[model samples]
Target: MGTTARETDRERHDEVPVLEAFTRFLGLQRGLSPHTVRAYVTDVGQLLEHLGGDEDADPLARLDLTTLRAWLADQRRRGMSRATLARRTAAVRTFCTWAHRSGHLAQDVGARLRSPRPNRHLPTVLAVDDAAQLLAVAQDRAGDDDPVHLRDWAALELLYATGVRISELVGVDVPDLDAGERTVRVTGKGDKDRVVPFGVPARRALEAWLERGRPALAGPASARALFLGARGGRVDPRTIRGVVHRLTAVAGVPDLAPHGLRHSAATHLLAGGSDLRTVQEVLGHSSLATTQRYTHVTPERLLAAYTQAHPRA
Candidate 1:
């Protein structure tokens, strides 16, 4: 064989500028969510950190199956979950692919990187009557017609009624609501927008809050975020979660979250005989498969309902 070859350290450190540029490119060109961008940045940063201060070798030329596998092993030793590892692997692969395409690297070093499979845990949901009772308890807390009380009831009601995610709920603007039609347009992940209708209870609560509460909370400097915080600022997702937990606890549901209400809504809709496609559209799921997971059914319950209702049975 010919003489053994190796890359210099300086060449490796030279790719730092390219990596940083690629990160900026992702933000500008991909229009990815801030959360996604942060995840990508963290993953790439971890790899760079692992490489230490070595900069003489071409980073791409030095990278190979061994270093990639070693990095994964190191992460695993540190007790990172398979899901996190998988995400990091994906980030590295994407970075490598972009680097190769942009001519920053001679070869795609991460071409063979394989992410470990992640667990698929089913989401938790609340029963219909239990959810109703919870909502009723939340409604009871309005202290003889207070706007904040009204707002809390309305928030929970809309979440359960529409099956919209908490991010979508908090992001709602005043113009998105159409009280006459009892419908609101929600922006879901990937900025996909969908119109969801609310029932009489949700409608009433929303109207009361808008008329009585929002005016009290709206500040001239504040942007048009639908839910206002205690300080008259745009409500953050964390605050929405805290509100859900606090209200749900009073309703005898200590485990409920905003997403749990969404799950409850989908399951209840399916049990109430709403077709999957209709539920899919209402939930604004980009794919039917994602929505189908909430089509919950207990085999015994299905059998009993069939036996009780079917003339043939």
Candidate 2:
């Protein structure tokens, strides 16, 4: 269903040279990773596709507030998620601003383009007791069990214990873990690296699996990845997701995933009176505003506390 090179060439009439040049500029000047660059390119591609393929149409010249608004409306009609719409809006705005600065366009059409405000949905997290139960199950599975089962158990335990992303969890290498310091170095989004500490439970599970489980499964040609597939290459995020989903289902929790564990960790930390800044650092959130949302308490909890102490009540 993907477009072929011939199909793309056949469809392009007005070739906007500036767009390609700008994309290359973003790659070279911004040092954005390949994955990030691809996303930005895709965002801009949607705009170009909207403009149609008329060679004489001059896509950049046709761009205006009306055109931009129409594009956004069409996206909404297509049922794009708010987060996705926001990201695409940012991409178009940035591209237009850059084009004007570089003298490619006389006016920045995207200047007035406002991104849709994303809905503020509170993330769901497990209760502390449920999190404990999940970890206990992981620990139980890690002891002298099947090698594959033990590795999966350790992987899930670390996720619940540290609340790291599935990508970050799989990105962890063997050398990055400093057992003496009780910290593991993780590379998060935008290739940012941080050291996150795990508790005794996670540490013990990891130690047992690393010492026993990994060796049994790792063949002589196995790679040095911290987590491995059956063939001994690095574990993929999908694999991690599947493992967590199945294990959480066995615990009788529906709709739990690796990210829910992350939310649970942050929520529990805030509820336990851990400082907001510390939780932000643990989660590697880029903005404090993002970290602050986890601190919101429900009215029911507040009313329960008030009822216990109010003299009039």
**How well does model 1 score by local distance difference test?**
0.79
TM-score of each: 0.83, 0.82
- lDDT leader: 1
Write the residue-wise lDDT of candidate 2 on 166-213 in tens digits: 888888888988777889899876667899988887787778778877
* Cand. 1 TM to true fold: 0.83
**Per-residue lDDT of candidate 1, residues 36-91 (tens digit):** 77798788777866765545544456667689889998989999998898888888
**Model 2: ten consecutive residues of lowest lDDT:** 7-16
User: Model 1 segments beyond 4 Å from truth?
Assistant: 1-20, 58-61, 300-313
Please give the lDDT score for candidate 2: 0.78
Assess the local accuracy of residue 283 in candidate 2 as a C-alpha lDDT between 0 and 100: 92
